[model samples]
Target chain A: MNARRLAEEIFVPHRLVMIAVAIGLLVWAGMAMRWHWIPRYYDLALQGLWRTIWLLGLSCLFGFMLAVPLGLAQAAGPRILAAPARAFCTVIRGTPILLQLWLIYYGIGSLFPQFPWIRESELWPYLRQAWPYALLALTLSFAGYEGEVMRGAFKSVPGGQLEAARSMGMGRFAIFRRIWFPQALQRALPTLGGETVLQLKATPLVATITVIDIYAVSSRVRQDTFIIYEPLLLLALIYLVIAGALALAFKLLEQRFNRGMVG
Target chain B: MLDWLYALWPGLETSVGLLSLQPPGWGGNLLRGAVASLQIALGAFALGLVIGTFGALGKLHGGPVTRDLLSVYTVVVRAVPELILILILYYAGTDLLNQALQAMGRRPVEISGVVAGIAVLGIVQGAYATEVLRGAIQSVPRGQLEAARAYGMGSVQVLRRVTFPAMLPLALPGLSNLWLIATKDTALLAIVGFSELTLETRQAAGSTRAYFTFFLAAGAIYLTMTLVSARLFNWIEARYRRGQVRQ
Candidate 1:
């Protein structure tokens, strides 16, 4: 065999064997816990993972919806609209997400019961829960950062193209719908993906407020088992897999968006 | 309607009433926390710059193995939650060190929360800085470096005189953003019980059940710091671009 092929054969087997051993060790740990704890830790982790996913999904969805108008205002006409939106973005982006989460959960939450209308309202039940406050904080955080990104993306869409659309008898909103939004979104996809990953990371802070997300579950399991590294390592691995999947999906979407555009 | 709006404002209670001059030392406690947060962020930012510069340089000029390792570090750091990494690193670092000490028949060493916090923040910040600095380094014209080398300057000299200065302007925006992130990441250290702003706010709020007061104070302090730093970074950027023609 040639030298390169020989080197590959020698190196490749060791990597595969290492991978097998790691997986084996991981399985052994889980099985050990399952037998010792009566499947308790496993159940908790699964539930936590699900909660984290749903939390991330809802916050990102609503945040995106909120961001669109805020972002448009940032890049579109009047100073009145842009100024407040800019300030909103600044304050949100400037502070820590954890602080915001706490402010919403403990800060605003304590105040909710004091208001007669809010206390008597149907939505108060949900608002009183930690999850809603978590959701509120996460949604606002996402909108703030993502709104700025979308604003930058909006400004990046060439003015010439907008002028061309205008000359073609397109109404302002029509031009935005047809030309501005898509192009801006396409360009912003990569940054948005990073922000989404950040949003996923931010979900764990909700755990601090007793939301029972993945991080909270792992922390609980760790406290119970007195096995800190394994649960935390497993948590990291789960996040890695999710982030990898997101990065790959973004790449595919980016390629699809750029298909006809000249390099 | 005005009354209703006012009622929604939490009624100047202890929690949201810090500015009303009721609580004796509550505001002082939060201000101290903000200062601690700033100190931690500044330390972490310095460490991050060093780590980022080296990582960027390694990625730029090192062999395939070095590049691959740095790439893995960036990817993993970027992917994982900061909270998870901090907790793991804090616990595992102490554990591993204690194990090593036992092996060597030496006394075990405890890692301080402050040291651990700075180290973790620096590490994560380095991953992002590496990417930012790498781009900045790439943006510096190849011709400038080539000319420096042709003048018989050593590699280190070329980097010092040409590469670092040229990349500063390009790197400023990303670096400043990283600084902001570093400041914010200090709050994460509070989870590990570091007595930064957020943790202090939590303590104050919990003790007094005045959640809105302490946190609002904390948030406003953080906002002030952010704004001040934003202006500082902007001024630095302007200084960097002084001689260059605006596009």
Candidate 2:
């Protein structure tokens, strides 16, 4: 990426001082910062990190699955489907996801036990758990945001490709699977990556619902140990690392997508 | 609570009763929370815009150290989640201030939640706003800046009269998006037990056993704010866009 050359080009004298100051701060943090609690919480922190990752991954997967139909409905469906789809995206996008999370978890979660069949069902135990409600809210929130992105992606697809597919005897579903969906997905991929990081940021909201993700664990650490800065700083570093890796992965994915397409 | 209101309008007995502005009804509390949310959002947005303008300008026109420092701030703030940032910033900020006060032999003052919330969200908003404004400022036609200089205006004068206004139209959409983000981000303060709309709704719904009602009402309030803000931004954009190049 020519990072070395670029850094050399931009390395003015004051910038050097800035770099040195940053390094010094890190060193001070390492040498002088608190550390007595790490051994106790590290195990739980790891588990919390795992929970956060899975919540991010599964919800994004499920959400994108939901978004495809929502996007398609908004882009090309009849008024009946499109209006409701549009309304869903608008309402979801407008409100805070924290509100939505509480709505699903507390609002709908409280309602479930009121029904006799829900209590009697085999899935009742899972439904009674907090993670499912967390998952549901996260999934719906993702679907809402991505639905708008996908709508733009769908609308932006070259009309000629669809016309050509139709002339070649491709049915609507076949055309969608082959040319339409792929192109839309490729177009949506960049925004999808950015939104995924936002989803990662949002995974912490489950903590509010008592789902014990990484942020929740950190908060618990603070409550128990009466230490605040160390845990939160660690949490920030973890998030930064994950966000960086995710960014790099998306960059590679974008490169691959570009490679498969002829110029 | 809503005897007069119900008398004025029939068949709204239950749902309307839940939202009455009088005692035993939480509608007034929710509205107060909405006002608090708006205050925070508005204060944060203005503060962020100020920081963003400077950050963007520094990135664009300042020295290498300034650019690098601003970039670091933006990147770090953007990568981390706001909830974590709020937690860290809210406490750390207040603690640092008190320590500074103690060092100066002054008694530490309690930091108000609204002010702290504004400052924390403002910092977050500033990062996003910087990116938006930097792009917007860059989108200003270079020729316009040159022309202002051509007219014998000093650097500050050029920025005041030409660069800022020239960039407004291009920057409006991104800035507006950030405003909406600011409003939504205030809900994160609910974690810190700030009395914002989301937390207020939770308390109301918790007490009432009417979770769907209060939460949905809060949602509607947020939605309305967003739509209204969109309209307001559009009007501001149109106002600034008089007699400009259209394409």
Candidate 3:
């Protein structure tokens, strides 16, 4: 086929060109601001961005770790564990994450000082900080919502495959590892990507508790400079870059994992 | 022994550090806040339904430009932090409105916090709703439309009678999920000084120095709303699924 025809057949949009134009506009805006404004506030912005990444990364890591067991419990047949797990998921998923954050940061944080054991403990300092509470809230939020996604994925795995593995003299652990894990993870990948994006968005809520994430820095900048749109525009562009990168990364990872599977 | 009992009942309110949820106190404020939260959620959901319907229609049938424009809208809304979006919209919306008024030699007008809150939440929720509805509409079988057309039904008639009724069963589950999200998104409105549940709880907590009591009260109220809504949506889903064979 001719090059033009082949290009049409490939069904590629002008997305790369559009992305380039967006980046160019962002750079141009940055340079325009850098003459005086960005130089003065660059450190603050960078610090806030760093904190945002740290908050999101740690919460997502711990939350995903905690979510696996929660997800498993929901799918597990044993009523003893599953009932509580089900209730936990329902409560967490049902309520707003902001409410959860406030409940932890304000409600529990205030109550902590009253307990002599809690106050005297070595862990008291960490618990006293807003970041820890924010982390806890975000983690709980993730486990609640993402746990459901994973549970659904787990259920999607064909029972026949597990039965087949069992009949092959495979131990329960071996059967789960070989037959269930891969299929569930593969099924869960897309949903998990969306959840991670949401977790990233939720990172901004930490700022409400006075943790200086990117949104906090932008708010500070807006207040200090009294230039409402500039700081916000810059912050939005930064988020756009981060979100685009995340989406691209997830796409690549999905392709890598799905290799040799039916397209 | 009483101290130990107090520890178990931290917010019991019979003594120092006791939490209480009874009426004629913080409970009233918290419930009022819950009412405000529900109001905003309902308003936003209603607005989202309208925007989402048009958005889905545009994506499904409109020109390439409309599709690209809507794709950008969905992507940008989904990607951005909703809190940031609301803040930007709230501030910029006021500023622009004031500017326009100034140009017309009119007095500078303050945007109502409730209106701004509902508008921003509705706009954001609409993006997700669009995607949900688009998927739902697409899931309706093509044969149904063809069959309706064969009966000499017009496109609008088919859409009203056949297409809508068919898609509602598929769409209700997703729309209910969006409704839950809309309810939660209202909590973010508290950050902008909206007199919602979170803000009310904060005020009560700050003044009384009873952060634990008020926040916990607020959390319970929110949980009650969410759980009740979940049950309600499940009923609605069942109603929509009437006559359909279960899988």
Candidate 4:
């Protein structure tokens, strides 16, 4: 085992000196960088952070749920079902999410007003807002990427297990639920975590549509103060923390499923 | 007969005109944007590969301090979203450059958007590329390197003969993925006001108020790029994998 060597590689005097330099820079930034804008914008930043979390959480949940059906369609369904699912996945994955967001927000959002029923409907207010389109775009994009992952996961589940369940007189649906789905779910869980972080990184795109996510809050501060680096440096640091936390949460979830087993 | 069909869907004529390639139409602008996007992607990808080669070498062979610095660079770049990173690099890089110029008593010069776009996106791509290339290099069998050394080959000669050849087939898949990503990430530059495909689509959609038509067209252009790139990479990967045992 090269564990000792790795430890030595990481813990040398050179690394220590570098770490000291890093700490020094952090201290200088903390003391010297602009701090005056925090009090005025702290509340907005909080709200924006909450909005970002909401977008990431909701989109990922709904998207993964949608992905199951899509994956199933591709992995096992008839030609008719598989064709549309494949096309949908390809189209969504092929283009930038920014274009899709704009298409929904600017293109379809503008189309809604021409119809009297849409304007007069009870759900009109929520439909009129930008967040719904943002949510739809993010959810669809996540689903598109996850669907391909799930397809491989579903296919990787051993066929013999399904046959054994069938031999036990289980119905098709029961075999899928009890035998196939669980194995596939476990297989897919590892990739799903990284995908979720990707989904988190993508949440900032919704801000383009006027949904005030944390990235938007940073952009606002920059525009307001005409001070560029401070807000952006802070933004980068904040994202780093969130990304770390997200990765940790996923690792914990994986460990729970892992039952202390590791590779 | 055609008149009746046109009357049945009145919006069709308007859409056709708006999307047409003539003077009144904005198709030219969108085409220009697509060309610009392709240029930026190519430039950025080349720059990224250059940086990635050094980064991978530094990580594999450099001192602990160098490794730590490289780790920090990759970690920070990977942690933040591309959009935020683009903003920070675009603004801060220009700001710092001008400041340095002032200190040198030289006049401040504007960084062209194309050059800036390439530099920022290339740096971002380099981080991911470093990881990919490092993994590829590590996968190359150590025995081959030892044999090369036994043949009286120096480190550089061994790298040229045994290492890079072994690494290429392994690295091709990831490098191709990075290429696709570089192409797509050019769209993010639109957010920073770069005149890329997305911005042009938006402008076309806004001016004509035919949003659906223009966006759909732009999406088609992007889809074509993706499909074409996918096929091209598949061919390249196939060529590199020639005579290798199938996994």
What is candidate 3's lDDT per residue for A162-216, written digit by digit as tens? 8889899999889878878788888998888888888888888899899988899
- In candidate 2, how many Å is residue A174 off? 2.6
RMSD vs true structure, all candidates = 4.5, 2.7, 3.7, 2.5
User: So what's the TM-score on candidate 4?
Assistant: 0.95
Model 3's TM-score against the true structure: 0.90
Best by lDDT: 2
Off by over 4 Å in 3: A1-35, A115-121, B1-11, B15-24
lDDT of 2 by residue, B116-164 (tens): 9999999999999999999988888788888889999999999889988
Among these predictions, the greatest DockQ belongs to: 4
Interface RMSD of 2: 1.1
By how many angstroms RMSD does model 1 differ from the true structure?
4.5
lDDT of 4 at B63: 81
Could you give candidate 4's per-residue lDDT for residues B197-230 as a string of tens digits?
9999998888878889999999999999988998
Go through the candidates in order and give each one's C-alpha lDDT: 0.87, 0.93, 0.84, 0.90
Clash pairs detected, candidate 3: B11-B18, B11-B19, B12-B19, B13-B18
Model 2, DockQ value?
0.77
